[model samples]
Target chain A: MDIGQTLYWIGLAGCAVFAISGALAAAEKQHDIMSFILLGVVTGIGGGTVRDLILDRPVFWLVDPLYLEVCIAAAGLTFFAARKIKFKHKALVWMDAAGMALFSIMAAQISQQWHASWMVAMVMAMITASFGGIIRDVLLDQMPVVLEPEIYVSASLLGALGYLLTCSFQGVEDGSANYLALAIGFSIAFSVRGAAIIWDLRLPKFPPPAAE
Target chain B: MDIGQTLYWIGLAGCAVFAISGALAAAEKQHDIMSFILLGVVTGIGGGTVRDLILDRPVFWLVDPLYLEVCIAAAGLTFFAARKIKFKHKALVWMDAAGMALFSIMAAQISQQWHASWMVAMVMAMITASFGGIIRDVLLDQMPVVLEPEIYVSASLLGALGYLLTCSFQGVEDGSANYLALAIGFSIAFSVRGAAIIWDLRLPKFPPPAAE
Candidate 1:
């Protein structure tokens, strides 16, 4: 398949994974189906929507609402199937990790295509990968995992950095090397996030103020 | 003043008020100055940024960064002055109300100018007024006031509806009636919100499911 087709599938998979993860999270709240659907769609689209806005590009879902359709379908499916699923929390974390990995690389690629500086690309990648889950957590009134002492955003940042470095070294010729970069970036993000989840890795916390 | 100039001033005032309100909210967390600035700016711009993205307009801050400058300045001022302010919570609520009042009307007007349907305008106004505070609360790990069964989004919706109704009746010729519409819409939103704050009004909550 051509690079564009491959990226398109990756983007679709990312959206579906994020949507399912959102539904899984919402399930813990025992919210109604409508709420499940709302949360799912928001989680799926939130990251990319922000990235597009910042880059002044047409919103991805708006440009091709198939993405939205996919999220809604995924949410509906999860709503019914979630009852049968054991280990939901673990499933949610794993799905979220996959979504983060996929989205970070896709966003970094888009940012590079838009000719954004590496710094901007990295930031955009982090936003694209993490903002969806952040929105879900915020709406659910849970502390956002990114704000937790976790390695989530760090993993995304590393993934984006890895992708940019690969692109820089391999030259941006839009060839097979692009696929290699995507694989490397995705592997870095997923592995880091997976390890963090397994080991319960945490970032250092700020020391309490001296007076406190 | 011309209607355009008047609306411009109102928009700027809205940004500043929201920024101050954000800093006040962040103060309760005892975060660092940088966190204060981050929260303030996000709260000031979050709503309108979403609106612009949805409406396919150049983001206001991106097009003219003066709005960002205003938010940063307001945040900085609030950080230094917050300790001396009596009734910090009350001050935050009032500032937030003012921002909501101003931004709702401004967003409705913009939506109308963009030829959005009245329904779309109302929804956009709600988003523009409420999303900023929602974002601030999310970041601070507090329940968003809008989702607390308060009359926040309702007030914003009413403000936008009032503005649209006035525009329809008064004609959209950009005349003195436009000023009157702005005043009427602002008063409606502010009074509704003020009354809610004073009375501690709340929307009815859904009953718990039978099993629970």
Candidate 2:
């Protein structure tokens, strides 16, 4: 496939992963089907939608109907199939990490295309990678995992930084640079996050402050 | 002030009101200053940002730095001054309603600029008026007030519909038509919401579904 096709499939894969993660999160809440679908769609599109809103760009789902349909479809699949799957938590964490890794690199590259500085690109990557999960957690009345010293946001940041560095240092053509950056960034995030899932890795949290 | 200046001040007023409401909401959580500020800023701009994102337009805060700055400043003011105010709950509801009224009309007008249909305009108005509170409630792990059978979203929808009707029925020029619509819309929202608050009005909730 060409560059455009490659990116398209990558983006859709990210959305699908997010969708499954959303359904999984909803399952924890004992919510009904509508809630599952809503959570699924929101988790699938929330990050990119927030990014587009911040950047004042057209929402991809609105312009292309397929993205929305696919998210709902993915959610429906999960709603019926989730109970049948063994090792649900393991599946969830790995899929969520994969989604975060893919979206982090893609977001970093897209931010670069928008001529954003490295700082902006990295921040966008974090947002694009973790915001969907944040939305799901919020809807479920749970603390966002990223805010809980989890490896999720840090993984995305590492990948985003990697992507930016590769682009600036490689002096390659745009197309090749993006592919290479994506490879490097995705690898960094995937490996680190995978290790985190396996080891239950987490950052340290500060003790609660004394009462005023 | 010309129309531009008029809208600018109105928008800032809406932001300030939202900022105060956000701070008030955070007070319920016993959160620290940073969390308050974050919640305040998110509440002030969250709705509009969501609207712009869904519509695929530039975020207003990014284009004008003042909006962000003002929201933060307003939040800080509330952080310091909230305790000193008497009748705080009354102040919150009144100020929030006022903000919703102005933002609903303004958002409806702005959505018209994008050539959205009346349906889209009203939906945008409701989003601009209520989404911030939704975000705030989500962050606080509380149910959104708009979902509590309150007249909030309904009020905004009513106002937006009134605005569109005025535009259609009146043969006045665009400028004058906009002003008149704003007046009509604001009046509808403000009076209804005010009465609701004073009378403790609420729509009946659906009876709970039987357990499966």
Candidate 3:
């Protein structure tokens, strides 16, 4: 596939995965159908919405109705399928990792197109890859997983830096370089997150000071 | 007092009121101190944050520490004082109306400064006046009050248009026009909301269509 098509498919898959994960999360809370749909739609589009707002563009889903339709379908599918599935927590973690990996690279690419600084690009990528879950948790009245000592934002940061470094490399053809960079970015994020889960790795904690 | 000082005090009072409203709302949910603080901060600054993000400026509260300090104090005091307060709901609605009015005028003034079209300015004003509460509701896992068949967005819309009309007539001489416009705008919103509450007024709803 061409670079553009590859990116499109990756994003679509990411959206679907995120929608499923969101539905599952809502199911854990025993929310009603409308609430589940709301979570699914927000999780599917949240990253891109934040990115577009920051970029001062009309939101991507608003521009394309298909994104909304897909989210709706995914929410319905997830709601029914969740009842039949076991080990849902494991599936949720991996699906979230996949979504984060895909969105981080996509956000970085869009930022580069806007000619923003690398720092800005990276920040956008992290926000795009992470804020959806944060919003989902906050809306569910739970503390966000981002605030937990996980490899969440850290993994996205690594992926974004990988994409940036790949863009800076010479002698690679344009089409080949884009795919390679995206693949590398996704792999980095996915691998880090998977390893963190398996190894139970965590970032250092900041203990609250004792009150007098 | 000069118009600027008047606006300053009004905005501060609005922030304090919104913060108390947020604290009360969270208290109803039985949220802990941290969540209460977070909700209060969001309710007080959320509208301006949406405005700045849309305008592509650094978030206003982040740029101005005074806003953050005020929100924190408002939440802290509200936490202690809520038990002693009667008619909390009445106070919240009134304060929210004042905040909405001030923000609508301020948003219009800012948009005019940017030299945007009047339509864009009005839209910005409405967004600035209503988005915080919308966001607070959404984050609290409730349907956005704006999307409900309520007078919320309509009130902001009317207030914004009132500010615009006043500006067109009186011009922005010595900022007097600004505060006067805001007062008129707030009065309009408050009156409309009060009428809606008293009369149980609701927007028209369409009946469900026949089955396909």
Candidate 4:
């Protein structure tokens, strides 16, 4: 199979995983079916929507309905199988990491197509990777994962840099380079995040100073 | 005062009003002080940020911190006065209408400066007037006002059209034309909204079809 097609399938898988994670989150909160479906759709397409809006392009899902269909199916499956699932939180984090890594590379690649500066491309990648979860958390009335002094944003940044570096080295001539870079990026982010979860590695927090 | 200076003052007052409304909303939710402050800042600057971001211009508040300071002061004042204030919701709607009217005109005027088409300019105006409150509602886990099938979007559209029509008639030289248009817009929106609230005039909802 061609590399681009392979990467497309992998990205779709990532979307499905994230949709399941979103459904699990909503189920944990005991939301209705409509809310669960809404959350799933939002989580699956939210990153790409923001990226396209910021870039002044039409939304990706509007151009192709596959992403939306995948999200719907994932939500439906999760709704029926919620009781069968175990280790929900662990699954969520891992799936989120995969989704973030995939989206980051996709954003950077799109920006590169637009011939944006490297810095702008990197920023777009980070926004695409993290802003969906941020919006989700904000809507859930919780502190965004990005603001939690976690390694989340840092991992996304690292993944984006890895993708950019790979693209720079091998050039865009070989389609396989894209897949290779994405794999490397996703592995880095997921491994670091998994280690963080296991070892409880966290960023330092500052306490409020004494009142005068 | 010159017409430009007068409009600027009115716009600043609108900003303050929206800031207060934002603080009141936060107070209702019983958020922490910092969260309240953040809400105020977002409500005050969110519209302009969305406008500038869509227009691909530098964000306005980042260029001038005065807007931020004004919002912060307004939030602090509202926090202290919230309990003592009577008819808070009424005040919020009136203040929001004023802000929406002013922002709609400002967005159109700015878009005209950019030499954008009238259609694009009008859309930008509507976005600038409504996006902040939409973001606020979305963050608060409520349905966005824009999606409520109400007169909110229509009000902003009409306000922008008013500004454009007045400018055309006055040759953009008559200083009073701006304020006249703004006043008309605000009055129309506020009166309609107030009547709706008082009389319980709601848009018709779609009835569900009978199950088979």
Candidate 5:
């Protein structure tokens, strides 16, 4: 398949992963089926929706709604599977990391397509990668994982910045090098986030003020 | 003043109020000034941003950015004032209710202007009216007020539906009836939400199913 087709499939997979993670999060609340679906769909689309809004682009899900269908299907499947399978916390984290990697790269690519500045592209990529999970946690009444002293947003940021740097350094004015850049960017994001999860990595906290 | 100018001023006032409410919410966390500004700006503009995205319109603040300035100014003021004043819980609630009322009417009117169906208008209105506070609560790691079995969203819904009903019944094709409708809509929303806050009104809980 061409690069466009590859990216399309990967984006859908990312949405599915995010949706499943959301359903898993909702499992903690033991909410009803509708709640699972709602949470799943919102988590899957919330980030990209916000990104598109900020960028003044057409909302991705609204343009086609196939993304919404994918999220709904994923949520429904997870809701049923959750009845039998005890979802592990690690499994959820891994899935979230994967989703974050894919979304971060894709969002960076889209931002580049829109001719956004490097800073805006990186910020958009981070938002697109992280905000979905944040929305899910909020809806579940849990502290968002991003707000913790974790490496989550940092990983996404590194990946997005890596993607932009790869494109620019390779002189991708004709856009021929974007496919390789996308892969490299995705890999960087996933590896950093994955390693952080396994090694329990965290960013350092601000030092308390010196005693008077 | 003309209705257009009146509405414009009210919208700015609403943004300021919402921004202050967000800053007040952040005071619970005692975060730095930057966090206060971020939270306040997000709460002030987030709902309308979502509505504009869904409606495929240019985002309101992007078109002018005056709203952003208002939010930032309000947040900065609140941050300083918080050091000197003990903010009351009741004050926040009342401010939130007023913001809800103003935003609900404005959103309903905008939906009508965009020629949305009654149901779509009501839903958009509720989303625009409530999502700001929901986002603020989420960022603060608090349970969203809308999800707490309260009459918040219902009040917005009622007001939006009331506005549309009044417009349609009165044959508002000429658009001259909109000012009266806006006033009525705002009054209904504020009265209902205010009453709920004063009396601790609540929606009924689901009854437990009978044993087989």
Candidate 6:
């Protein structure tokens, strides 16, 4: 498959993974099935939706049915399987990292395809990787992970920036470069996030104001 | 000014109002100036941004600096003034209602200008009115007002639908129709919200699930 098609499929896999996490979140809230589907769809496509919106392009899910189908199916599957799932928190964090890495790389590459500046590409990468979870957290009335002390946003930022800078050679074909960037970016981001999950890596909190 | 220009100016006013409300929300949390500015910008343009995104159009703030400028000014002004202001809770609700009404009506009209279906227009109306507050509440880690015990989302929906239906007369010119619709929609929405604030109008919550 071409780079575009590969990103498309990989992005769908990311969506499914994100949808699973969203469904799991809704399950934690003890929300009904409809809420599960809603959260799943929102988390699955929310980032790409934000990206497409900013780029003046058609929203991916609205333009195509497949993404929504995958998200819904994932939500349904997760909802049913959640009862039997062990170590749910650990599973969730790892799956979320996988989805974030996949989405961030794809978003950065696609933004580059749109001829966006690297800054815009980085912002799109962060949004694509994090906005869905943000939306899910908002709906569930919980603090979003992106705003928490985890290394998630920084990981996505570094992954997108590093991938772009490292793959700037003119001689390399676009398709191969894209795949290489995706692999390298995903590896770097997933590793950082996995470290955060395992080691409780965090940005230091601000000290309280001195006697106000 | 023509209908389009009138709507543009009114929308900017709405942005400022929303920005002020966002700043007020940040003040309630005693967040830093940066958080205040972030919330202000997000709340000021967030609803319209969502509308543009869903419609596959360029983001409003990204396309025009005016929106961002207003949001920043409001945020900065409110940040400095917030300490002097007391009894803020009452003022916050009124200002929020105003912003919601203005945004809802303007969004409905703009959606119609894009030749969107009435259903799409209504949805846009709701998004444009409520999403900002949702963002603000999420940032503050509170239950969003739209989902809270108040006649919020339904008020926007009714106002948009009522205004469009009422303005669909053969003799009215397009400009007059838009103005009339805006007035009618804003009035309808604002009145419902005002009553809700005064009377604590709310959708009846489902009684806690009986023993699971």
Best by lDDT: 1
Off by over 4 Å in 5: A1-88, A112-127, A134-141, A149-212, B1-13, B26-42, B53-85, B88-91, B115-124, B135-212
* Model 3 agreement with the true structure over B64-87: per-residue lDDT tens digits: 446666876887666666656677
Instruction: Tell me the lDDT of candidate 4.
Output: 0.71
Better of 3 and 5 by DockQ: 5
Task: Give lDDT tens digits, candidate 4, residues A1-212.
Answer: 98667767876876787787788788778788887788888888887887787676778889879989999999888888886778877777777877877777777777777666565566567668766776667657765555444466567667777877887787762223377777776777677766766787764322112211
Tens digit of per-residue lDDT, candidate 5, span A38-152 = 9999999988988887878888998979999999999999888976765557668888999999999888888777666666577668779878998998778777776555578
* Tens digit per residue, CA lDDT, model 6, B127-187: 9999999888876788898888689998899888767876665333232436776788899
Provide the TM-score for each candidate, comma-separated. Answer: 0.61, 0.62, 0.57, 0.58, 0.61, 0.63
Q: Which regions of candidate 2 are displaced past 4 Å? A: A1-20, A23-46, A49-98, A115-127, A134-212, B19-27, B30-42, B49-95, B111-124, B138-141, B154-195, B198-212
Kindly report which residue pairs in candidate 2 clash with one another: A53-B53, A56-B57, A56-B58
Clash pairs, candidate 5, are none
Report lDDT (CA) for all predictions: 0.84, 0.79, 0.74, 0.71, 0.81, 0.80
Q: Which stretches of candidate 6 lie over 4 Å from their true place?
A: A1-9, A23-42, A49-86, A115-123, A135-143, A147-212, B1-13, B19-42, B49-91, B111-127, B134-212
Model 1 bad stretches (over 4 Å): A16-46, A49-91, A112-127, A134-144, A147-151, A154-212, B1-42, B53-56, B59-88, B115-124, B135-212
How close is chain A of candidate 4 to the true chain A, as a TM-score?
Answer: 0.89
DockQ of each: 0.13, 0.14, 0.08, 0.08, 0.12, 0.14
Clashing pairs in 6: none
Over A97-125, each residue of candidate 3 has an lDDT whose tens digit, in order, gives 88998999888888777666666677678
Ranking, lDDT, top scorer first: 1, 5, 6, 2, 3, 4
Query: Residue pairs in steric clash, candidate 3?
Result: none
Error of 1 at B148 (Å): 6.3
The TM-score each candidate achieves on chain A is 0.94, 0.92, 0.92, 0.89, 0.93, 0.91
Scored by lDDT, model 2 comes in at: 0.79
Candidate 5 residue B35 Cα shift, in angstroms, is: 7.7
| Better candidate by DockQ, 1 or 3 | 1
**Residue A151, candidate 1: how far off, in angstroms?**
4.2
lDDT of 1 by residue, A113-193 (tens): 766666556756877998899899988988776655557877897888888888878778232338878999999999999
